[model samples]
Target: DQQVKQNSPSLSVQEGRISILNCDYTNSMFDYFLWYKKYPAEGPTFLISISSIKDKNEDGRFTVFLNKSAKHLSLHIVPSQPGDSAVYFCAASRTMEYGNKLVFGAGTILRVKS
Candidate 1:
């Protein structure tokens, strides 16, 4: 069973506007949530992350919020720019015997239009 899901396949936002990407998880054991951004022909880069102990985390134009009760999370980007257009992946992890293993969503494509 897939642990993470990004229901929306794509989203479009105007430059300088706000873009919201949503994700949901079924595993209550997940202790960490992460969002990654990927450009065309490039690997995904770490963007923002939130721990289960916290509800929100922010970094400049990016923010991540986790709702444990709902098993949902969202990534927000204010003043979205054209360069921000890319695929975003939501991942979750929990501590294991060896280490943490990430369970990733299918990914959502974001288009920031100028």
Candidate 2:
């Protein structure tokens, strides 16, 4: 079962604090990992991604680290802001698949208070 799982259903943080989200997977076939942030009704937008070939990937305020050996990964946001408050979804897929189909976790809702 290549299912992605986010154990935490929600997280809350101060405006200038760090926000860390965790994820786990059981499928050994998943070689690519991604994080997406979503607002109320809009679709999720790709935030960051790491290939199984690499251990880490970062983009601006977001960073993703993949530990394939343990089937774990995390997304970190430094100095989290109110704008960063949203549902975060961890997704995985085989990088070399014919078409990229993402399997997403239930999602973690982040709340940032000023």
Candidate 3:
């Protein structure tokens, strides 16, 4: 079974609107959550992240929320622009003896229309 899941395969939004992407996890050992955005033919770029200790974290137009109790997280983008369109992946990681190991959910494609 996958530890992390993104039920929605895709999302679409109008310019200047808000885009919400949801994720769920089955692992309670995960302490860090991250969101990454990827353009076609390129690697994913880190977007926003939230620790289990905090409920939310925001940076400019991007925000990430974590609900530790529910094992859920979401990414919100305000004033979505066409350039914001990309595949978003949610990743969870836990610190191990060697290093941090990450588990990524299937990406959700976001299409921001003009």
* Clashes per model (N, Cα, C within 3 A): 0, 0, 0
| Number of colliding residue pairs in model 2 | 0
Positional deviation of 7 in candidate 1, in angstroms? 0.4
What are the per-residue Cα lDDT tens digits for candidate 3 across 11-112?
999999999999999989888999999999999999988888999999999999999999999999998999999999999998653145778999999999
Q: How many backbone clashes does candidate 1 have?
A: 0
RMSD of 3: 1.0
Stretches > 4 Å off in candidate 2: none
Badly placed stretches (over 4 Å) of model 3 are: 96-98
Q: Per-residue lDDT tens digits of candidate 1, residues 1-114?
A: 889999999999999999999999999989999999999899999898998999999999999999999999999999899999999999999866325578999999999999
TM-score head-to-head 1 vs 2, winner: 1
Choose the strongest candidate by lDDT: 1
By summed lDDT, the worst window of 10 consecutive residues in model 1 runs over: 94-103
Q: How much does each candidate deviate from the true structure in C-alpha RMSD? A: 1.0, 1.2, 1.0
For candidate 3, the TM-score is: 0.96
